[model samples]
Target: METGDLVRELRTARGWSQGRLAAEVNAACGTALTREYVSGWERGKVRPGPFYLRALAGVFDVPQAALDAGRAPGRAGGAAAATTAALAPSVTSDLLGLGFAARLRGGPSADDWEARLDAYGTDYMSSPAADLQRRVAEDLVVVQQQLDAPAMWSAAARLMTVYATTFPRQESARSIQWFRTAAEAADRSGDVGVRVWVRGRGALALGYGGTATGLADLLADQALALTDRPSVGLLHATLGKAYAAALRGDRPAALHLADRARRIFDAAYDPSARLSDYSIPAWRMNGFLSLLSARLGDEKQSAKAREAALCELPERLPRFVTHLELHKGLTLVRAGDREGGLACARAALDALPQERWCGTLQMLMAEIAA
Candidate 1:
């Protein structure tokens, strides 16, 4: 097989687009290779350099020799030959280890589904979107099949939350659809906690996507009503409502909800609780508060929230770090530091994966530009 054929086959097998494959290659090798470059290589118009070849090997989990042999006209037949010699061992091992045949016949275990959900959250911002979407689709199948199992509802809820957060702008309808499915599954399984959590996430998605702020408020209010007492979920849902109010230019309502959310978070938040994708940490809520205060033109409160966010920065994920920076940048802009804010916003955007450039970030960038 030719190298181009091999690259194309491996990428297609994993359900990756050319751009996504290029992104994965760049992430693996710490080099910037563009979609056009990948397209050229796959079209046989250009050959991959050593760096790209090695990166492709890592991305596809194959040997360098296999890629090299694929490029050699007389070395082997094409991807078929390379697959037989280079891919068989790993493929067979994965099939056996994952119980591929059995899973197809009997569905995945709840534990397996939970593990995949956790993995999705752990790598939410870093992984290639095409790969992540494929995994989510596969996991959703298993989750749907196991909806009667209470534990699976938790997994399903997490999956929906991650899906909504990761693809808020690009897949708005699909995200909402899955969120509804997650809520229904949780309710059917009698998991009110998961149901409320999913509703809160759905509200955030709606607000962030600028789809319907009223619906966002309704969902958040519904979630708040479902919680009996103070809880992290209630805090998140209140914050979601606050965020919706902020986006809608309702300053008084936004500030009131922000204060309410903070009070609940202070009372109910347990540091030792296992953090899921849906769980909003104190630092993240602070960041959101900063954005809300900035939007409400309360420079003093915005600065205070910014300080709190910065103090808690070290505990955040890279994704949240960038998010916090964006919030801080917006606060700075609201304080009349346009140049400084633009620079900080640009830096945060550059630090994240391209697939993670959602509507909220885009709106912040527009504000900075203005």
Candidate 2:
């Protein structure tokens, strides 16, 4: 196949329009290439430059060689075949089986949806935010139609988590709205555990928004009330309350709640568990505790928590690494290492996609600069 045919095949396989593909390429390559440029390449009207070819390879997760190899006489499509082979299994699965027609036919199974959500949650730190956003948009539509289905509540809750984590600063209102919708879906499903989990997540999002500390406390308390025994969900909700207390200058209450959260986390944490009620791991709890400690003026305790979080860092979850780094940055600032703290903040920002540029992080950067 021609290079143009190869480009069209790959783009179509991913279900991305020319414009969307161009946006992704720009984000990945830090370029200003346009949809018209992409269209020209696809139409064989213009050949892509070396930089553009590299950008396409990065966007497609393929090697430059795969993009350069033209079709061989007997082999049908050399570059396209090589590109497909180089793609990740998940991407290949989408290319082969997932499309608009498949979506119109009612979408993938709940297990498949859960698997994709797991992948998104695990890879949030390093994956392109554009890809995550596109997946969420596609899944949200199918999930909305399946509100009455058994898996809908969990699916909605996962989307809420993604939006809250990935777009916290830029889309705060939308994130809260998604969390509320997830909570309502959980309620409609009559799943108390799901409700508690969703509410706990919402409480964190509320705390992150700065002005909703009181509502954060209320939502967390409500979630705790729904639980009889100690759980990861309750632990997360308790941490949310601690954050709220710290935000409001109630250091005593914040420290007390933080201690309680640590105890609950100790009792409820399971390293081998596939999923937690709140979708937060114990190490992440340590990161949050470090932030709370920093806010409460306990630099020693903050350092201790940061060390623990670093020790428990998971391999695949770069987001947790970013979170831990952010906490460390704040802790360093509290310890008077302003320049070092700013460097750490910049590293955290560097790990994220440009489109997911966080408001909170920008605020931290400004504070350090000031």
- List the global CA lDDT of all models: 0.67, 0.66
lDDT of 1 by residue, 284-317 (tens): 6777777777777787887787788778765545
Cα error of candidate 2 at position 71, Å = 51
TM-score, structure 2 vs. true: 0.63
lDDT of 2 by residue, 4-87 (tens): 777787787777899999877654333577999889988999987775666576466455565667332123344356656766
Candidate 1 is scored at a TM of 0.63
Look at candidate 1 and tell me the lDDT of residue 148: 57
lDDT of 2 at 174: 38
- Report the C-alpha displacement of residue 265, candidate 2, in angstroms: 1.0
Cα misplacement distance, residue 180 of candidate 2 (Å): 1.9
